[model samples]
Target: MDNSQRIVTIKDIAQELKLSVSTVSRALRDSAEIKLETKMLVKEVAARLHYTPNPIALSLKEKRSKIIGVIVPEIANNFSSNTIAGIEDIAYKKGYHVLIFQSHEKYEREKENVQLLVSRRIDGLIISLANETQCYDHLTDTIDKNIPLVMFDRVCHSINAHKVITNDYFGAYNGVEHLIQQGYHNIALITLPLNLSITQNRLNGYKDAMKKYNLPVRDEWIIHSPIDVVCSEMTIRRILESDNRPDAIFISAERLNIICIKVIKEMGLRIPEDIAIAGFSDNPITPYLAPALTSVKQPTFNVGQKAAELIIELIENNNTTTQYRTIQLDTALDIQASSRRRQ
Candidate 1:
């Protein structure tokens, strides 16, 4: 009020309202300690003056960064990018900042990243487990340290915590069963790190579907590769060139689908003509691909939003070291030209 026109603060509101700073603070925050009339008046005045609380000050007082650290397998992956965007959308609205880290699918890198986030004094964490992350000691340490953690997409089953994940088992099993229905008996599966729960679930789904259909499931039909373009493409090429070629291929991971497409193109094979294909992907471009790829679409954006909501709830309630909840969201099968039977 004494200087140039500027936004209002708690002190300014207190001065105008002729109340104590603490009372004004409580009123503006709608704390139950303040009288209802005072809260309404303070809220009305604060709205008029456009007074916004300084999160930095609150962060310092609370010994929190008001920041949520997000860990992903790779930033460049479509699913990871979209999921992060969803997380940020919610985090920003809740007056939180996100510090993103890429583990590059390495367990050591993931551990180091989590430690760094902890050292930075982040209020909470949201993570998509790395392919190589089998051990949950580092994750368990976060819970022990009283940091709210919400795992999304790829989660560790051993260390139970708030988890938001797609139903990988049903998704992969349905994809393979669809191929079987299309009369493709020789179905092959391409997957990433088998140690992770998502990988295991999808593999199990594939196996169960094969068993239910009485299809031959040879060990050689399951191809494991790094979650990357080069490795997946090479694996796909090897499978294509093998004497025991599969009439259909199922990719458990999204990134592997692109590599499979590239491999099929290189081999001059047509979709659903030379081989039927399906995979797990929520990539927007998936529908636009040549002979639009059939895939299992996870609710990536919803998963991110739900994870943020759960972490914030955990932080607010001071809930730690109790029974954790696992939330599994169902996936959708996108029937497209890639898996359509040649008529």
Candidate 2:
């Protein structure tokens, strides 16, 4: 509680109304023991004094729940699981409990998860928006209720909150530059759906690199696929089988990148010699792939750690405020045989 505004107790209301503490309590509780006029008067005064009866109403004031609620799209993904590890590192060290939930890329499920976490009276919330979530009114509702909310990967910019992400644009640029340095000029970008900031940043990076090198960025070389394996395989097969197939490929999503490798090998194309590749990867098995995949590695665990630190900052702060600042971490390109050509 702020020194300027102390919590209003039933005794204070009783003193103001010239009644006993028990009488004021009964009035505020709507107990049948109290007269209707007395109950109404007490309730009015309680609201006017900014009195809060529960943890949710109090926001981050007196009582701390010491628990953080985390929501993500998929827990099975290597990226998400590693990020959760980072979050747990900070949360447990600070003596806070972590509750995890999955939205499975569905908007309705995501909304339900938020409502459930809020009802549980979590101290703060960290979320990665679902692919299907276009409206942020539900998230804004959480903010309106004075909850501390932070968004990470696949976040919506319309919401005013702290965000943590890797520099996808530069990551993609560096990955493509690796391919260009290896003498692969016709590079195709098989990216995630373009509605997201991460995917769009990566696409722009690829385009800018091609423009800087004076290489043609053809419309046919760009493919948009959601998080579906079937969609990824279909798009990869179509482009790879084309008569004018790219000499190299840049994939934006981890799962999609893995899928592209599978499709390429099945098509009997020699990596680097036929079609080289590089993109974002968190999969540990990438090194063991046939050609040892060249990849732009995101700081998944570090992103989690940073997000935990920021959300805890929001939860523990006495003053209520929203700072729409983004903390961006750099991605490292793991050069390997897939994109590296040795003459």
Q: Please give the distance, in angstroms, between residue 189's alpha carbon in candidate 1 and its true position after superposition.
A: 0.4
lDDT score of model 1?
0.86
Task: Please state the error at residue 208 of candidate 2 in Å.
Answer: 0.5
User: Which pairs, if any, clash in model 2?
Assistant: none
lDDT of 2 by residue, 1-343 (tens): 6775576676778888899988987777679988898888888888887776655434445467788999998898888999999999999999888999999988999999999998898889999988788888889999998889889988888888899999999999999988888888999998876777788899999999999999999998999876778877998899999999899999888878768888888899888788888879998888898889998898999999999998898888931654568999999999889987735
Per-residue alpha-carbon lDDT of candidate 1 for residues 1-343, written as tens digits (9 for 90 to 100): 6565675688888888899999998887679898999998888878888988786677777866778899999998678888888888888898888899999989999999999999888899899988888788999999889889999878877666789988999999999999888788899999887888888899999999999988878888898887667867887898899988899999988778878888899899988888989999878888899989999988888888888888877777775546778888898999998888745
Mark the 10 consecutive residues where model 2 has the least summed lDDT.
54-63
List candidate 1 stretches off by more than 4 Å.
Answer: 1-58
Superposition TM-score, candidate 1 onto the true structure = 0.81
Per-prediction TM-score, please? 0.81, 0.80
